[model samples]
Target: MLKEVYGNECSSRTQVYKWFKLFKEERETTEEDPHPGPPSTSKKEENIEEISKLIREDRRLSIRGLAEKTGIDKECVRQILHESFNMRKVCAEMMPKLLTPEQKESRMKICVDIPNNIDIS
Candidate 1:
C-alpha cells in the first residue's frame, strides 16, 4: 500500500517492518532515546592544553597516570593523546606520530609539481 502511494520513494520493506515492530512495542516516535551516561567533557580545549602542559613537564606519564592526575577518564586521556596531539606509545612513553606541517607541505608540493611536469598531449 505504501509503495502504491509513494512508488520508488517509499522505505524498503525491511525498514517498514522495523518501524512496525517499534510501533507495536509502544514506541512513541522514531527519535532515538538518549544514551545513559554522564555527558562527555574530557576532550575540551582546556583539558587538552592541561594535558599538553603535563606531558611537556613529564614525558613518562602513562594514560592511567594522566587520568588520575587530571581527573579525566583514562579513555578520554588516551584519545586526547592520540587524536589531539597525534602521539602514540613507544617504550611506555608517548611519542609523536611524526607528520610535521612542513613535511606535509613538502608532500603536497610534490603532488602539485607532478601534474605540472606531466603532459597529457
Candidate 2:
C-alpha cells in the first residue's frame, strides 16, 4: 500500500517488504521474554554468590559498604543476606536438664560397657 502511495520515490520495494515482515515478527515475539514480568534489578547467581562470599568473609560490613563494593543496593545486600542466606545474629541459651537416677545409672552403665567392648550392655 505504501509502495502504491509513494510510487518510485520510496527508494526500494525489497527493503520495504523486509522491514514490514520484521515489524510483524517483532510485534508477536515481545510477549515471551524469559524474565516475563518487570526486569530484575539484582545481579545473577554468580554475582550473588560473590556477594554472599564477601558477606561471609566479613559479617560486620555494613550494607552500604557491601553495596559500594558489590555495586548493588544496600537494601538488596540486606535482602540477599536475610532472605537468600537466612542469616541472623541471635544468642541462644541451652541448659542441661537433670536426669532421673535410673536414667543416669543406665547411661553410666552403657558408657562403661561400651568402653569395655561389651555389645550386650
Q: Can you write out model 2's per-residue Cα lDDT over 1-121, one digit (the tens) per residue?
A: 7458545544366555555665766643244332223234564687589777886677666667778998776777767767676664333211124567987899799988886895665
Q: What is the TM-score of each candidate against the true structure?
A: 0.51, 0.42
Q: Estimate the overall C-alpha local distance difference test score of candidate 1.
A: 0.81
lDDT string for model 1 (50-98, tens) is: 9999999888999999999998889999999999999998787787888
Which pairs of residues collide in model 2?
none
Candidate 1 runs further than 4 Å off: 1-38, 99-121
Instruction: Please give the TM-score that candidate 1 achieves against the real structure.
Output: 0.51
